[model samples]
Target: MHVPDGFINAPVSVAAGAVAAGAVAVSLRGARRELGGTSHAEGGGERTAPLAGLVAAFIFAVQMLNFPVAAGTSGHLLGGALAAILVGPYTGVLCVSVVLLMQGILFADGGLTALGVNITVMGVVTVVVAYGLFRGLVKVLPRKRRSVTVASFAAALISVPAAACVFTAIYAIGGTTDVPVSKVLTAMVGVHVLIGIGEAVITMLTVGAVVAVRPDLVYGARGLTAPLKLRVGGELVDAEPAPVPVAARSPRAVWATGLVTALVLAGFVSFYASASPDGLEKVAADKGIDKNVEEHAAKDSPLADYGVKDISDARISGGLAGVIGVGVMVVAGTGIFWSLRRRGTTDATPTRVPESV
Candidate 1:
């Protein structure tokens, strides 16, 4: 959920900001390994590096297509579970954080001052909880493509409510309104539970589609089975690796497909999405949590509220804004990922040993 400004007092907001900063710092370091081919199949980092950016853009697009969850309440993709399964946990955190940042600064969908809280709750909490649960489930379940999808569904389903609970806890500590913590908690959790189902279905379908086409590209699918070992001269050695298909070696096809899908979702399909308030928004209004909500600092931005300023046609203006958002997100995300990938490669390089020594 995007916590707007004035929802949290200054002290607690600053504390959350520190926590978010620390989490981002750690994720940056971890993303290097994930993008450097150290954490997945051979050459996976190179392939994954490009896909990470596309994943962020896709998440941003999908978030605009909210679906009706209940009467007057809607929900959208959070993207943490999907990102972690597609890329890796560290990169997943960065992906969601980037989307949140873009939404806050450009779309005014989230509050500038509450950026830290949104990152902490939506970015950090979702990735950590979803990835952790997905990993655990993957270990206990059968090692198959279907198993991975199943795990993705379960992890995604739980992450939404988990985030809601965390937000409730944060509000309990520093809520700016006079609402009762118990009422807020009950309402938040109840609505979010319904929202989580939609999240699970979306995650399952997306992960399954990618895994069906290119299981090697999915981080969570890696190491599903131990490599076969053969005995040679009374010693065991790893079996010969299979050849990778030429298409699999190049990420261009997948990248193009993903980018096109993101463009379609945000630029065209979002027009049909539900207009009802999302779970958090509804709960906030009902529980008086918005009693102290402040106006977004970027309320006058050209792209504020996912629409272009001075554009009379609602469809054209919203579509243009969505397209712009996707473009910016992809460029920014790719730059960050590529830089991390390069740094990782450099750090992984071994110093040359002297032959004369």
Candidate 2:
């Protein structure tokens, strides 16, 4: 749900800008820790550099295919769940940033000046809230692999409502029009609840697939123990293999899988996606706030609204757009993640106190 320009007033947007800025500041330190103390600076710098751009592009493309739920309302994958699952949380924030920047500049989706608001509402808050809850659930629940998927689903489901509530609170503080806060809250939450279900499933599936393939690579699965049955009657027993070296595994393979998944979702599957306005659009139209929407700067772009201009073949045009979007997002997301990963190292050594102290 991109909060376009003019939905929230200037003062509130600025306030959100402040909040977003503070969050990014906090995430920098958080990302450092998440990446581990700066000791073994080998693989992260390169792998994480491209992930930044990839994150942005991924979020952008995924947000396009709004799945329908109710009359006049639809929902799409927010990527908060997906990003936090695939990449670390701090990098997740950066991923959303790249998507917001590209959307505002190229897609004319969210407003340029209001980019900060979109980032705060969609990027920072979602990652912080989702990742925090995801870790907590993982801690409390049974340490089964399925638990990870279950936790991912729940985290994604709750995050959307939380985001809706946050938007309502933001609008209450800086809404441009005199719409009733309750109506906005109800509608936004109501529609987004449906969207959150979609998010949960998508997040779980994506996370599950990755975990199954590269359990060691997933940051969330770090501490969980694998089964170790003792030898019986001198017969050999099968066991889960040792964790893969993050460096040994090919980034290109991971990127290819993720990019293929994104392309399929956006390119072909999106054709059958819901054709209704999303939560924000429905609420705005219902609440009369849509009138205040300013023109998107990129409206004149040929690729505006997820279609190539004058392309008669719906499948080809839409497919090309999806492919391009996937390419952009993968490259962009990879760049962002790679950059953060570069600044970081994989070592997890604890700092020791000085003997004198």
Q: Give the top-scoring candidate (TM-score).
A: 1
What would the per-residue lDDT of candidate 1 be over residues 293-340, giving only the tens digit for each residue? Answer: 999999999999999999999999999999999999999999999999
Task: Give me the overall lDDT of model 2.
Answer: 0.74
Colliding residue pairs in candidate 1: none
* Best model per lDDT: 1
lDDT of 2 by residue, 1-357 (tens): 888888888888888888888877777666655543332222243444543455456566678778777887888877776677656787677677777777677667777767878878788778878989999999999987888888888988988888888888898888889988999999889988888998888789878986776565565665666456667689767565555687647756766666666678778876776788888888899889877888887888777777777898987787777777777766665655555554554434446888995
What lDDT would each prediction earn against the true structure? 0.91, 0.74
What 10-residue stretch in candidate 1 is worst by lDDT?
37-46
lDDT, model 2, position 297? 77
Supply every candidate's count of residue pairs whose N, Cα or C atoms clash at under 3 angstroms.
Answer: 0, 32
